[model samples]
Target: MRDLTSTEEFHELAANSPVVFMFTAGWCPDCRVIDPIMPEVESTFSDYTFVSVNRDAFIDLCIEKDIYGIPSFLAYANGSESGRLVSKDRKTQEEIEAFLSNLSK
Candidate 1:
């Protein structure tokens, strides 16, 4: 997965391919809860541009997106958002699978 540090970097990722953008923080417990599981998701969706943006380091970018929480996932395709998942609870693999399947269609 790639780490996007700027708004322009995120925009580039969004325009390049199907992107799964994750907004997270170093001290967020929720983010830590799902950190290990993320690599599995990344492996499953090799075709996607998996991008992680640290909320603290990129506060301006997060504000522009109106991000309301840590561990928010946004999917982009065709230069626009196609889906989103945001929460503290660890999302099930089935949920992730279903979301990706729906977006890929």
Candidate 2:
């Protein structure tokens, strides 16, 4: 997954393709847990572009997007939000896969 450096970059990417923004932080254990598994997830969901957004670096953006949770997942298409897997609870690979699966429906 590519790291989103700026909000403008995120918008540009989202405007063109199906995007899944992964909101995470370096200190988040849950985020770390998913890191190793993300390669496979990305491969599985090849249709979607996955981008990583560090919550600490983009706190204001996170707030603007109402992403209050670490390791949150938000999907977009044509620059519009399609679905989200945002929560304070820990996320599992199954849940992440399910979230992506449901987005297609």
Candidate 3:
């Protein structure tokens, strides 16, 4: 997964490709829990570009996207949102896979 650098980069990538912005924080335990499974998830969903957004580094972006949780996922394609799994809950690998799988519907 790629680390998000700036708001501009976020928008640019989202507008251009199928991008999944994963909102997370270094101090968040739930975020750490998902870290181990991310590589597998990313590999499975190879069509989407995974970008890790640090909550602390992009608080304004999180607020704008209505993301009030760590380790949330926001998927975008063709300059618009395609799907999202935004919540304060701990997400399982199954749940994450389900979310991504259902995006096209």
Candidate 4:
């Protein structure tokens, strides 16, 4: 997963192809849980570009995007929002896979 440090970089990446913005924070436990499994998730959904955005680092952007929780996922395709799997709930690998499956539909 690519780390997006700024909103500009996020927009640039999301403009062309399918992109999934993973809103996370270093101190977030849920985020840590998903960390190790992300490589597999990325490989499974190779069609989409995955970008990691640190919510704490980009507070304003997170607010603007209505990212209220860590380990949230927002999908964008062709500069438009395609899907979202955002919540305050702890996520499992199956749930993540389901989210990607839904996005494809």
Which ten contiguous residues of candidate 1 have the minimum total lDDT? Answer: 86-95
Clashes of each: 0, 0, 0, 0
**Over the stretch 15-98, how does candidate 1's per-residue lDDT look in tens digits?**
777899888888988788777887888888877878888988888877787777877888988888888876655666677767
Q: Which is the winner by lDDT between candidate 1 and candidate 4?
A: 4
By descending TM-score, how would the candidates be arranged? Answer: 3, 2, 4, 1
TM-score of 2: 0.95
Give the alpha-carbon lDDT of every model: 0.80, 0.91, 0.93, 0.87
- Cα lDDT of model 3 by residue, 59-95, tens digit: 9999999999878999998889999999989999999
The candidate maximizing TM-score is 3
- Candidate 4 local Cα displacement, residue 18, angstroms: 0.8
State how far residue 19 of model 4 sits from its true place (Å): 0.6
Best-matching candidate per lDDT: 3
lDDT of 4 by residue, 1-105 (tens): 989977888877777779999999888999999899999999999999899998888989888888898889999887788888888888999999898888842
Q: Any runs in candidate 1 off by more than 4 Å, and if so which?
A: 88-90
Q: For model 1, which pairs clash?
A: none
Candidate 2 lDDT tens digits, 1-105: 999989899878778889999999999998999999999999999999999999999998999999999899989886688899998788889999999998852
> Which candidate, 1 or 3, would have the higher TM-score against the true structure?
3
lDDT, residue 44, candidate 1 = 83
